[model samples]
Target: MLFSSLLFIFQFLPVFFIIYYLSPIRFRNLILFLASVFFYAWGEPRFVILILISILINYIAGIFIERYDRNEKIRVTILVLSIIYNIGTLMFFKYFNFIIENINYIFKGDISFIDIPLPLGISFYTFQIMSYTIDVYRRDTKAERSYINLGAYLCMFPQLIAGPIVVYTQVSKELRKRSYYLKDIEKGLRIFILGLGSKVLIANNVGGLWDDMAQIGYANISMPLAWLGLLSFSLQIYFDFNGYSLMAIGLGKMLGFDFPQNFNFPYISKSVTEYWRRWHITLSTWFKEYLYIPLGGNRKGKLRTYINLFIVWSVTGLWHGASWNFIFWGIYFFVLLSLEKLFLKKWLEKNVILSRIYTILAILLGWMIFAITELENIKIYFGRLFSFSISEDWIYYLRNYGMILVIGILFSTPFLKKWYDKQANKILCNILLLVIFLLSIAYLVDAAYNPFLYFRF
Candidate 1:
C-alpha cells in the first residue's frame, strides 16, 4: 500500500501503531513481522511467497556460513550459493523479460516472452539479503540467529518498498534490543509530516506540469518549454524520492531504529563527483562497498579505475530499470564524472559561477536522458532543447507554474532548512507543520494527481 494513500495513512497505520505499542516487548517483533507480511500480501499476494523464500534461503545460509567458518571451502561454497540464489532470483523476476527481448532483437528469433510479474520491492529486498549474507561471509557482522528478527528486518514495510538499502549491520542491534523514547517519537512525527508535505505539496503538484507538457507531444515542444518540462521533472523526481526516504527514516525512528540518511542537498553541488556523493548516498555507498571496492577500485591504477567505473555505472543504470536508455543515462554520467576526475574538477574549482552553471546544466541534461526511454523520442526532445526556439505555450506554462517552480528550486537548496534551524520558535514550527499537514490532507482527499515515480524501481 502507498504511504500517501488514505487507506494506509488513516486505517492501516493507526491500527498497526496502536497494536504495536500495546503489545508486550517480547511479542513486538512477532507483531511487526506479521503486520509487515500482511502489508506486503495486501498488494502482492502471490509474490509474498518470493520474499519468504528469500528470507528462508538467506536465514539458513547465514547460519551455515557461521557454522562452517573454520572450513574455508565450505564457507565460500555456502556464501557463493547464497549470492547466486539471491541474484538469480532477482535476475529472473526483474530482468528475464528484458533479456529475452534483447536476445530476440539481436538474433531475429521468435523467442516467447516470459510474462513474469515483478514482485514489488524484489530488487530492494534481494540486495538487503545479499548484503547480510556477504557480511556474514566476510565476518563483518555476526549472523542473526533469530529468524523473527531477520524476517522483520527484511520485511520492514517502511523502507521495504523503496529503500535507503538498509544494511543488516545497521539495524542488527536495534532488532535485538530497542527502546521507545517520547522525544524520538516526536522527532520522527515531525520528519514524517515534513516529508508528507514535500511529496504532496511540491512533488505531486510540479509533476502535473511535466505530465501536461508531455501530453502536448515532444515534437511540438519549443526550446524553453523543453527546459521547463525537464526542470519540473528533475524537481519532481528529487522531491518524490527524497521525500519517501525521509518518511522511511522517520518511521524507522518511531520504531526505535535509525535508518541512514539517503540524500543530502545534492542539487547544490558544483561538481558531478560531489553530486553523486550527495545524491542517493546509500546506493552509491552500496556500489562502492560491494561492487567497486571488490573490483580493485582505485587501488588498481588510473585506467583500471575508469574501467571499474564503467562497469559499475553500466550495472547501476540497469539496476534503475530494464531499458537501454537507463544504460545510456548511466554512461552519460560516467563520462562526465571521468572528465571531472581528469581535469574539469580543477577548472570548476577556479570559477564559482561558471561551475554552478555547468553542474546545473549537466544535471538537467542527464535528467533529460533519464526521463525519456525511446531513442527516437530522446533525439527529438533533445533537438528541441538545443533548437533555440520559443512558443506561446512556454509562456503560458511559465505564467501558470512560475511560483511552484520557484518554490521547488528554493527547496532544492538548504535555505529554508538553515533558516528554520536558527529559529527558537517551537510554537511557530508546530503551527507551520500543522498548516502543511492540513494542506497535504486536502490534496490527499482530492487525490487528483499523485504519482510515486520510483515505485517500479
Candidate 2:
C-alpha cells in the first residue's frame, strides 16, 4: 500500500484517521495496532505471522532483560539472544539467497538457493526491535510492560514500511500517553501534502526521464547524456526517499507521535562527512550509536577508527541491498570520507567553490555506482561518463528534462523552503500547497512510473 496510491490516499488513510480520532482515548493504541496489522497484511498476508513472531520474541526478551537486570551476565545473554533472533530472521529472508549465490560462484558448488520472500519492512522493524532490547539491557529505558504499546510502537503503519528508524526510547511516552490537537492536524496535513507533491510531481516525473535514458544503451550513450541520466537518477532517488520520510514524519505528527527528521538538504554538503551527517540522518545515527560507537569509535585512536569506519560502511552498503555494487558504493564513500578526515578536509574548507564542485562530482559518481548492479554494465556506463563522446541524444534529453532538472536541483537546497517560511500571510502559501496537492493527485491518477526506491532496502 503505497502512500501515493489512490487506494491508500482516498480509502485506507481516511478510514483510519476517522476511526482513530473518534475512538475513546483508552482504546486508541488498540485501534492503531489493529490498523497497522491490517495495513501490513494488505500487501503480504503471510508475512504478518513473521512480524508477529518477531514482536513476540522481542517483547518477551525485553521483559526478561529487565527481570534479570541485577544479574549482568544473564541480562547480557538475553540481549544477545534477542539481537540474534532479530538479525537472524532478517538475514534468512533478505540475505540467504544472496549468500548462497555467492558461495556457489566461489566454490563452484551446487548449492540450492532457498526461495524466501522478504517480509516488508523487515530491515526497519528488526532494527527497531533490537534497539528496544538493547536499551532495556543497558538500563537506558524500562522494558515496555504493555504488549499493546510495544506492538504499536514497533508496527505503526506510517513508519513501518520505510522508516526514520524510530528508537524505542524516543516514542515510549507517546505510546503510553499522547494528545491530539487541531494545530497538529493542520501542520501534519501541510507536511504530508508537501511530501506528496515532491514524490509525485518531482520524483516520478524525473524517474521517467532516467528510465528513458537508460533504455538508450550504455555503450551508445555519450558522455554528456550519461551524466544527465545519472543526474536524473540522483534527483529521483533523493526526492523519492526524502519525500517518503516527510510523509512518515507528517503522519506521525498527525497521530500525536513525534518522528525524527531523516534528511536535511544533504546535496548542498561540501564534504562527504557533512553529506553523511545530513542524508538519511536517522540511518547514519543508528550506525553511529549501535555499530560505530560500540566498536570503540574514535576513542580507540586513528587506525582503529579507520578500521571501524570500514566495517561500518561495508555493512551499511550491504544493508542497502544484497548486491556487490552496493558494497562498492559503500567503500566508494569510505575512501572519500577517509581522505577528507586525513587531509582533504583542510583543503576543501579553504576553497568554497572548489569544495562544492568536488562534493557534487563525487556524489554524482557515487550515484552512478549505486544506479547499476551488474559490474559489466557499470564499467560501460563509467566509460560513457568519462569517454568524452558526443551525441545528439544528449541535447534532445536536455531540451526535454532541463527544466525539471533545474527544479530538482533548486529544491535539493533550502531555497524554496526558506522562501516558504518567510511568508507572513500564509494565504498565498496555502494556495500554493493546494495547487501542489491537486497536481500530485493528477499524477497519481495517471499512475505513471511510480516506484518507492527504498522499499528494497
Candidate 3:
C-alpha cells in the first residue's frame, strides 16, 4: 500500500479523509484507529495478530512501569524487561533469517532455511511502542489509561508505514485533545500537493535514469558513468524518502497534529556531522537522546565521546538492516566525521572549493555502498569510480554527463520553491503551482511503477 499508488491516492486516502472529517469529533480517534488497522491488515493479514500482541504487551509493560514508580528496583527491572521484549520481538521477526543464513555459511551447519514473513511497518510501529514504554519508564510521559488512544498512536497509518518516528512525547497531548482549522487544512493540502509533485515529477523521472544506468553492466562503466549513476541514485533516494516525509507531515497537519520536519536540505551540508543533524532529524535525535546520552555522551573525555558516537552510528546503520554493507556504510560516515573533527575542519576552512569537492566525493561514494547490496559488486563499482576499468567509451560519458549535472545541481540547493516564490505576483505563483500539480498527476498516471527506497527499512 504505497502512498504513491493510485489505489491510495484515489481510493483509500480520499475515502478515509471524507469519513474521518464527517464523523463526530468524539469518535474521530476510533475512526482513524480502525482505518489504520485495516490499512496494515490489508497488505499483510497474517501480521495483524503480531501487531496486536506486541501492542498489548507494551501497553501492559508501560502501565507496570508507571505503577511501580516509587520502587526503583522494580522500575528498573520492568524497564529492562520491556526493552528486551521489544528488541527480542524485532530480532526474531527481522533478523532471524539474516542470522541463520550467516551461521549456515560460516560453519556449514545443517540449519533449515525457513521463510519468515516480515510484518508490514513492523520496524516503524515497534519503535513507536518502544519509545512509549521507555518514556513511561523515565517518567517523561504517563502511561495512557485508555487502550484505544494508545493503540491509535502506535498504528496511525500515515507515519506507521514509513515514519519520521513520532514519539509519545510529541503526540500525547494531541491524542487527548486536538482541533481542526480550515486554514491548517488548506496549508496541509498545499504541502501534500507539493510533496506529490516532488515524488511523481522529479524523483520518479530521476529514478528512471538511475535504473537505466544500473542496467548498463558495471564492466562497461567509466569513471564519468560511475559518477552519473551515483549522483542519480543519491538524488533519487533523497526525493523519494523526503517526498514521503513531506506528505506525512502534511497529513499530520491536516489532522491538526504537528509532525517534526525530517529533512533540512542535507545535501547542502559542509560536514557529515552537520548533515546528520539536518537529515532524518527525528531519528538522529532519538539515537542521541536514548542511546548516546545513556552511553555517557560528551560528558566524558574526548576519546570516550568518539567511542560513543561510533557506537551510536554503528547501531544506527544496523537498525536500517541486518547487512554488512549497511555496517560499512555507517563506519564510512564515522571515519569522515572523525577526520573532520580531528584535522579536516581547519584544512577545509582554508580551502573552500577543494573542501566542497571532497565532501561531495565522499558522500557520493557513500551512496554507492548504500545503493548496492553485495560487497563484491560495491568493490567493482568503486574500482570503476576511480577509472580502474578502462573499457568505457566516450558515448557513455557524453550521454550521462548532462543528466548527472542536472541531478547534482538540483540536489545542491532548494531552488524550485525559491524561484516560484520569487514571482511576487500571487496570481502567477498560483498559476504555476496549479500547472505543476496537474503535471505531477499526469506523470503519476503515466508511470506504471514507482517505488520509495526507505519503505524497505
- Give a tens-digit lDDT track for model 2, residues 1-457: 9988899999999999999999899899999999999999998799998888888999999999999778999988888898888889888898999999999999998989877887888889888889999888888999999888899998999999999899999999999888899898888888899899889899998887778866777888889999899899999999999999999998999999999999999999989899999999999999999999999999999999999999999999989888999999999999999999999999999999999999999999999888898989999999998998886888888998999999999999998899998862489999999999999998888776788999988
Q: How many collisions between residues are there in candidate 1?
A: 0
Model 3, 137-215: lDDT tens digits are 8889999887788888988887887788899999999999998999898777767776776677667876765676567
* lDDT ranking of the models: 2, 1, 3
On lDDT, the stronger of 2 and 3 is 2
Report the lDDT tens digits of candidate 1 across residue range 254-321. 99999999989999998999999999998999999999999999999999999999999999999988
When summed lDDT is taken over every stretch of 10 residues in candidate 2, the lowest stretch is: 417-426
Clashing residue pairs in candidate 2 (N, C-alpha, C atoms within 3 angstroms)? none
Pairs in steric clash, model 1: none
Native-to-model Cα distance after best TM-score fit, residue 97 in candidate 3, in Å: 1.7
C-alpha lDDT of all candidate models, in order: 0.90, 0.91, 0.81
lDDT of 3 at 9: 80
User: Which ranges in model 3 have alpha carbons more than 4 Å from their true place?
Assistant: 388-408, 419-425
lDDT of 1: 0.90
What TM-score, to 2 decimals, does candidate 1 have?
Answer: 0.98
